[model samples]
Target: MSSSEVECGPSFPELIRRKRDGGQLSKQEIGAFMRGITSGSIQEGQIGAMLMAIWQKGMVAEETVALTQEMMHSGEVLQWPKAWDGLVVDKHSTGGVGDKISLSLAPALAACGVKVPMISGRGLAHTGGTLDKLESIPGFTVTQPVEKIRQILEDVGCCIVGQTETLVPADRVMYALRDATSTVDSLPLITGSILSKKGAEGLNALVLDVKFGKAALYKDLDSARGLAQSMVTVGNGMGIRTGAVLSRMDAPIGRMVGNTLEVCEALECLKGQGPDDLEELVKSLGGYLLWMSGRTASLEQGQEALAKVLHNGAALQKFEAMLQAQGVSADIARSLCSSQCDYFLHLKPAEHKTELTAQSDGTVVDIDGMVLAQVLHALGAGRTKAGEPINHSVGAELLVILGQKVKKGEPWLRIHYDSPAPNAKQHSDLQAALLVGKADSYLASPRVAEFILPPKM
Candidate 1:
């Protein structure tokens, strides 16, 4: 049939069958199909079917690359001048609850002389997006024109823009279809969508934070490692120096979870006093990025340099500078926090009163990440659908971490919510997600995960 006769260029059923049967598609065919979907020429149902097929059969590296290029071409690619060059380093994280490390890491890296053009997103599942947390700061604008992004990067050494419709528009369409069809769990599709946006931005080096746990989307070490490897491979293939770091999500990253509250916690990290896990993750990722960018010779050197930036208070200054460059009013920073309370600057009161304590008082063993996230979501810290406003005051502030001793009457964690609706929903869910066992129930960490480097082409 002629191109004109085929409405979306290729029949949806035919393309779905081709991929489902492990057949390869030429770049043009895949591009045409994605273009049709994003342009509304193809029905959402057809697009959904294609997503499911791709998820099940998987895409070859070539197909994944083609898909990435097509999605990137579906939107505008950002441009920057050579004079603004200082190795631009940025980071991406797989979705997980309490994954707010980027909020502090970006500024800390920028303070160390790297230009960070950080594009962030909002909450998708249980984990919150960097843009959403930054939005909690009054009047901070995540939306900026491409030129404005470059300008802010040039002047302040950093900028965090929201995922825009004008950039990677095809991925935008595909992501929604995948979410609707339950095909989002596929590793190939996930890697393509994640890397396409980061690659399209044209950075010198990139760092990926791949998290796995009940609270994380990957859910286990093996799955998370595969994703990390794929992202690094694809990224390096596209000529971007990419490194992946696996992080623990057995519990929340810090003491806070809501937007404003997480922002406060992030501020604490920039000031060099945050949770041990959160700080370690941020420093490790930042160190790798710095090394990839050639700002430092090795991870040890990069960590040493990052430490000086933190110790001298330059990291906090860079963070405030980037916030101002992005149009956050000066008072927004001051009003949200200082050196005092890390939970909330104003100590916003919550109406709910509940705690999940260890009943038997053994070593804290397993905390279901997904269950904890769901409880918080039901309590209104996250959205049930797209465009839903997040309740910045509602989330969990964890007190007891893994392997910590907990007495029977001691509070394990505090649930914060403003009203009756979420209180009734969160209390029971929170209690059930935590499984406390005897001394031998302690979780073990992986001695080593896969290394992510460019293949021997």
Candidate 2:
């Protein structure tokens, strides 16, 4: 038989079987399978089976690169104008509780001369999403057509919007299957999903914040490191400058941990007055991005530049421009920045509330982020499944930080809820999540635990 009559290589099932049996897949096979996924030639069952196979038997670095590259080309790859002078950059975070870094980081970078066309997603499980937070601002839309996105980037130097249907459509299909099949934890699948969307953005450089601890997607440091390394390798292999920061997520980053509350906190950060931990995170990520794009000579210099922009009101101006470009009225945008109280009053209030106090005088050793996130979800701050509506006003606030000494009756946390009263279990869980001990036994957790550099050429 001629080469065309016999078909060139292995069939899709044969490729799946090879991977299932711990055999490596060639680049052509990977491309063929991903093309099948995008064209609907591959059935859902076969896709799920292939994902399970890859999850059980991991792919090597080369294989991962192939998968990432193929998925990236599965749909429209955006082409910016050749005359566009600014460097295009963006950031991604492994989902974490109370992580509003992107909200401020994008505009901050734009203010420093880099264009940030950020593509964001909605909240999943206990973590808050950038799109959800932006949606909290009345008239601030996350969905935009490609031409509008390009126009916003050219006009304001930054634009945060949700992924368009034409961009990385294959990743969307695969991600839904992964979520349903419990295959979301696989490193290769994660790398493919994250980079495919980011790569479609036509980024000049990328910074990743891979968080670990009780509240993060990867709960342990080692696993988080592995994921970070994988993403950095695959990202640079595909010709994008990538760096990863391993941050601690044992407790919420800022004071607030819900939708609207987080937006308020992020706004304060843009104004240069927010929680210390949150500020440190934003500066570190933004600094790396500036360095990667060659805007600064060193990381320290990048950090200093970011600080200057934040203090000189440049960052806030860029943020306001982005909001206005996205359809928010100038008056409402200023009102949101000046007084968030008026905005909160219009939303449904979490009328039923309770304060969690210290049982005895001691220092707070730890606050389990996972537990607090669960409590927030139970209070309707997050969705348990897709398509569920979230109550933006319901959440908890931390009154005490790690290593802070507390009196017996001092409030440690405040739980806000829409229910008449929190049930006994929620009350108990809230109390249990707070671990107080002797002052000498308490040790503060580092905000940025480790930094992973890009792969060496």
Give the candidate number with the greatest lDDT. 2
Over 332-437, each residue of candidate 2 has an lDDT whose tens digit, in order, gives 7776666343656433457777888988888999888888888888878888777788887777789998888889989999887886467789789889988989
- For model 2, the stretches where C-alpha displacement exceeds 4 angstroms are 1-7, 83-86, 339-349
Error of 2 at 221 (Å): 1.2
TM-score, cand. 1 vs. native: 0.89
Best by TM-score: 2
lDDT (10s digit) by residue, model 1, range 1-457: 3222244455667877788888888788888787776677777777887888888888887788788777877888766778645487789987777778888888889888888888888886577878877777667899998888887878788888887778888888888778889997887788889888987787888888887776776778888888888788778766778888877676677777777677777787887877777777777888888888878888878878777776677888888888788876777665444455444444454567566676667777866667777877777778868799877777777777777767787788777777645454556677776667777778655412444544441
Clashes of each: 3, 0
Off by over 4 Å in 1: 1-17, 38-46, 84-86, 334-337, 341-353, 421-425, 435-451, 455-457
The residue pairs in collision within model 1 are 214-370, 215-369, 215-370
Give per-model TM-scores. Answer: 0.89, 0.95
